[model samples]
Target: MRSAVQIADARANKPGHQIYAGRARAIIERASIALRSSTWVPIATGFIEPVLYLLAFGYGMGTLIGDISTSAGSIDYTVFIAPGLLATSAMNGAIYDSTWNVFFKLNESKLYQGMLATPLGPLDVALGEIIWALFRGLSYSIAFMLITAPLGLVPSWSALLAIPAAVLIAFGFASFGMAITSYFKTYQQMGLIQIVLLPMFLFSGSLYPISVYPDWLEFTIKLLPTWHGIELIRDIWFGVIDFSSFSHLIYFLVMIVLGLFFTTRRLRDLFMR
Candidate 1:
């Protein structure tokens, strides 16, 4: 009798849960359109910058630095920087998706306004856009890793885990960028994210180890999510797994949750206006 009653309750609760799905599906469907394009140009563009870094720094500067020390031990400078590049790639790709692409749709293109005219609400648009951005970041990560393969950079199985690690980092920052976007009214403000994030990308050990910086700077940079993500990927790629790896993973996850929380609230407020 209890099992029968529980089944009845579950069935009764299902409809209420399914109520908003139509709006969600519409938003996802709209975002997927640009993704399906033959747009080889964008893909080519993403690869060039990372490839330049790998060639210029990985080969050119590897001579000066040689093998660098880590918790595991010293590995090739190329190896150390490989994961940082991966993390930066993920970070930059996600920020672009969330900021420029989002702003264009929201303001210049008026696409979001059109979507708002439909059943889709701001929350639906924001959620779908973030999900779509995650998809883009994932695509870029796999391609970048494959490009890095012949360089003999991927060290082991844990190295493969960097791809998903990249995904999580991208999602967290992308959502955070989206949240920041809700607060801004113009492109002038958007440039600050680029200016700030680019410097963080360069200084966060994407090209060199963090200890190369002075003690104070090291302490400060370590607090940034990019630092944690870069360190985590560097550890995995170089086989330096430890408790700190778990800590880094937790940090990015927390960032993701926090970003989502603020972004949802901001979107709710924005569309209500």
Candidate 2:
């Protein structure tokens, strides 16, 4: 009877009942350690991918396209696409971390289960992973900006805010990506993410104006998160801050809230019960 009562008390005090344990930093530390030992090839690729896009589209195509008109007036084609690529860079980093890494830990390693068995709660794990993903996104943004700024790609000091804007974009995708990944149980299912991302990057006004499409197609593209991210960074990149900018900010804020809510709930459902 005493053993049963003790066990019951232990269960009652478990971290599963709490939304957060305030030990998310621990998880971040764990990720940093693991990253140190991992191959650098993947990280190098994430950084290089956007740089290649910028060079290929900004310089190669810019010559053919000439200046493009934005709300800020006629600008170089390279200037117009730079922020879009920054947003893409951020999305790529966050998606890689949140979707693939989280999927591996959630399924193959059972890492979250082990963490929960300790004092850490589901929110801690979710927040930690998302923040860790943000680091990857941040690195990409800073590195890209360094290269672009020196090459006369950045227009003004205001464009520096693109780094933080990229981080915000990353947070939105990382949160949503992790929440979505928690539902997958196999590698085959993971391929769906790539299927969606490629089309999104192509059609989200990243390379060219969406206005080229019909009104219906434009509206559909506008509905995507990537479009908002591109616009948000572009506005800041061009120093065109306005009411529409705040609306885009709100969109990602909502995404982060909803993603975290669903992810915490899902983790509890999967492991707590």
Candidate 3:
């Protein structure tokens, strides 16, 4: 009893044919509209937390510690930790949007379900949301850099690269965060994310060198995405571009690809099936 139009639509959406409809811009537009009316407190909080860390740890503790040695040579303790905090800022912003916000939309608002009911495919929704999260990350990075540069915490023009590096870091985290969030059904499960993130932020070489850890622990920290992100931003902040810099870039590129793949698949299973 199916009409021809319904039959054609089914054929178009069958299995693997229409995972993306090239309408993600619509989702981005919707996000932007929502953001315009949203409270600025959360965004301000993400920005302020890093600034406070920079003040307390970077300046206050930095005075007692003096200059620290990095791959870029001995630099002010303030300078060394600024990039790590910058990377952290980006991570916090993107993860907030992609995880908690995405969770609300997925479970509470049922936004993604409605989006998929339209012409938007799962890939479109996934990519759109990730891109919007990247915007949050980019904003945090820019605002942090603006504050740091005036304080002489930014050592070179090359440090501007950290902004883009922060975006890449955000993209990787946001992609994976959304994918992982799709699996959670309860607020208790969501608390586990904070638990993981807190430790990762502390031990990811943000405050001190991982060299202080046991060799096994050092290796484990290096395996973390945040460590790579911090290292990449730190290298740029000090203008230490090298083969290793490209390696860190490659790590995020791979993270992005795999995250997007899993997120798209999970969304398809949730709404399209």
Poorly placed runs, candidate 1 (over 4 Å): 1-25, 37-40
TM-score of each: 0.87, 0.93, 0.94
Backbone clashes counted, model 1:
0
Per-residue C-alpha lDDT of model 1 across residues 1-273, encoded as one tens digit per residue? 567446445545544322223355666677677768746676566656776888889899888878987776778888778888888778767776788888887678878777665544566677777777776677777887998877788887668988888898888888888888867888899888878887888888788778878899999998998899889888778777789898999998888777777776766566556
Comparing 1 and 2 on TM-score, the stronger one = 2
Clashes of each: 0, 0, 0
With candidate 3 superimposed using the best TM-score fit, by how many Å does residue 209's alpha carbon deviate from the native? 1.2
lDDT of 2 by residue, 1-273 (tens): 567446445656655547776678989999999998999998889889989999999999889999998788999999889889989989899988999999999999999999888767899999999999988988988888888898888999989998888999999999999999998888989999999999999899999889899999999998899999999999999898999999999999999988888888889899998
Model 2 CA lDDT for position 53 = 91
Model 1 TM-score, 2 decimals: 0.87
Best by lDDT: 3
lDDT of 3: 0.90
What is the lDDT of every predicted structure here? 0.76, 0.90, 0.90
Model 1 pairs whose backbones collide = none
Q: Candidate 2: where is the Cα deviation over 4 Å?
A: 1-17
Question: What is the per-residue lDDT of model 3 for residues 1-273, given as tens digits with 9 covering 90 to 100?
Answer: 997466547658456547886667888999999998999998899889889999999879999999988777888898889999999999998998999999999999999998888766788899999999999999999999999999999988878989999999999999999989988999999999999998899899998889899999999999999999999999888888899899999999998988899999999999878
Order of candidates by lDDT, top first? 3, 2, 1
